[model samples]
Target: MRPLADRLAALLGPLAVVAAVSFVSSLGIGVMLPLMPLYAISLGASPVQLGLMTSAFSLMNTGGQLLAGVYMDRYGSLPFIRVGTALYAAGNALIATARDAVSLIAYRGFAGLGAGGNLIGSRVYIAQVAPPERMAMVNGVLASAASAGQVIGPAFGGTVVELFDLRAPFVIVAVTSGLAFFGLLTLPVPKRPAAATQRIGAPTSALNRSVVTLLVANLFLTSGFGGFITTYAPFATELRAWTMLEVGLIFSLIGAGSVVLGTPLGHLADRTGRRRVGVVSTIPVAFFGLAMVLDWPRPVLYVITFIAGGGLTAFTASWFALLNEASPEGRKGRTFGFVSALSNLGTVAGAMGASAVWQLFGLPFGLVLPSLSALLAGLTLLALAPGRP
Candidate 1:
């Protein structure tokens, strides 16, 4: 067998290209995430409208993955990625020019189409090129790169927003996505077996049943996590009167923790087993959620968020590895696509649920809901015991 380094170097040219595209695209999305509520409020949007706008973006993102997966599986990865990035660039440009909440929501939904396609395409590309044994490590590297983008995007977004206007971030996102489009052009095209053409059979009910259960569990976990992030800065502002810059710093720290912990944890899973890593990682994630609900001081909250971020990344890397391992060979692309879509559903639910709770009970209670959700998700994983017969 070729050495791991040799295998990696052989794939690195394409992998790095894809990772850069993914990173820039993700950075653009992250840059806009924290600013959404602020922008909505400025546009005189009601709380319901704000929730709808966020949900709309996620719903389209979730729904679009299924279509993207089919297309990629049938045609190839590069074509879809190129088209997706272009759409994303267009959507960002539209968002920059949006004048009303409705326009913003519409534009965001368009962007979600690109986001969904790009994400699935990137994963499929990685799986196609990387050797099976080294898949986890490559995924870890991709996750870390994406996390790094999340770290830089917000701080950069915040700076731009502070200096220019909300539109500035979207314009910057458009430019980055355009760059990603060009980057994807340099990669190799995936080859498909001519006989194995794309076709729609009846849904694989049995496979979907098993996969859907996992997806729902992921949704709950994602929801809890998404809810926490969605509400976190607001919670800090209400509790400690922190400024946007301070909130951005705190968020960046969380991303940094993910970047730091993701690869080592991924390696541990690969060496040991995915189930072991899943179980171990879930514990810290649960506690991190609990800690966030405890009304700790700013410093304490920061530490807790970092720990939570680490645990979250560990769990995600292991969980994805498990999913990849468990999926049927022919259906792997669809399986992952379904999971991606479901996870986005969870994010939307989590964000909406947290927003509602915050309005009803307050920040503390809202935050507590996510902790409870995470705890429940952890329990479900323990019950399922993936990677075992």
Candidate 2:
């Protein structure tokens, strides 16, 4: 057999293509995400409308993944990826023309469909291509690349908004995503590789119990994360009196932390149990959430947010690896899709829940909501002992 180096070398071309696609697509999304609240606010969106806008995106993303997962299992990822990129580009472009809160919310939801397709397809492609021993590390690298995009995109979007206009970021996102869609055309079509024989239907028993446990764990954790992220920009603006540039920098720090830590954590997860790492990471995540509730100086806010970002990033990398390891062989696509759908469902619930609470009480309670939920997930996962089976 060829040496492992040679084998990996052969896979490099395809890996590069996938990574590029992931980076560019995520770049487009990152550009929009931090600025989304500002854009909606410009359109006169209330906190409730803001919550609904984010919820709409998550809802559509969840639905899209459910559909894409099935089609990917039946057919392949390349076509879905291409179509998804096109739609993503279109959605971003259309959002630039949105003149009202309702139109912006609708456009964002439409964009989520494309985003979901791209996310699921890229991950499934990675699962299919990487060897089991290296899967987590590869996934981590992909996550890191996505993080890198987040780092750059937000800063760029912030600068654009500060320099030019609120609408400029949407236009830039559209142009870049269009370029990324063209980039997709140059890549060779990917085929789903064969794996261990899989039973067709789900009886709950069809999958490893650990897999189910991990899924449940993700549901709660993702909800908390979603709530935190959705509230992040808005709270910074209204409560802390931050500029758009400052908000972008805070988000950039989060992405920067993730990019710095993702690969090493992935490597560690591959060696130790992913569940163990994920469980440990959530502790700091919850603590930071609580910490953020405290009124701090702007610089202190950056430091705390940075550390919280690292914890959350570590948790997600390990969690994703665990999901990959726990999935049955032949159904990687659908299995991941299920997780994606569930995770987004949690996101919608968390964001809406937090927004409601924020509307009622204040920023502190809104901030506490997600962190407390994460604590609950961590405790539950510990009780479940996810590594046992």
Residue range with the least summed lDDT across 10 consecutive positions in model 2 = 197-206
Candidate 2: count of backbone clashes, pairs at least 3 residues apart or interchain: 0
TM-score of 1: 0.84
Q: What is the Cα-based TM-score of model 2?
A: 0.81
Clash totals for all candidate models: 0, 0
Clashing pairs in 2: none
lDDT of each: 0.75, 0.75
Q: Residues 224-316, candidate 2: write the lDDT tens digits.
A: 977887677677788778798876676777787778877787777777866676777677667666655676566766776676666666677
Residue-pair clashes, model 1: 0
| Per-residue lDDT of model 1, residues 1-389, tens digit only | 56876977889898888878878887886887788788877877788888788777777777678788666656766677788888899999998888888888899899988888888878877776776666666777778788888888877888999999978998988988898898888887755433345333423342654455567668888888778877877776887577878867766776888888877877777777666666666666666555656655767767766766676777777666656655555566777787877677677688889999999998888877887778666566665545531
Reference-based lDDT, residue 197, model 2: 44
Task: Give me the displacement of residue 109 in model 1, in angstroms.
Answer: 1.7
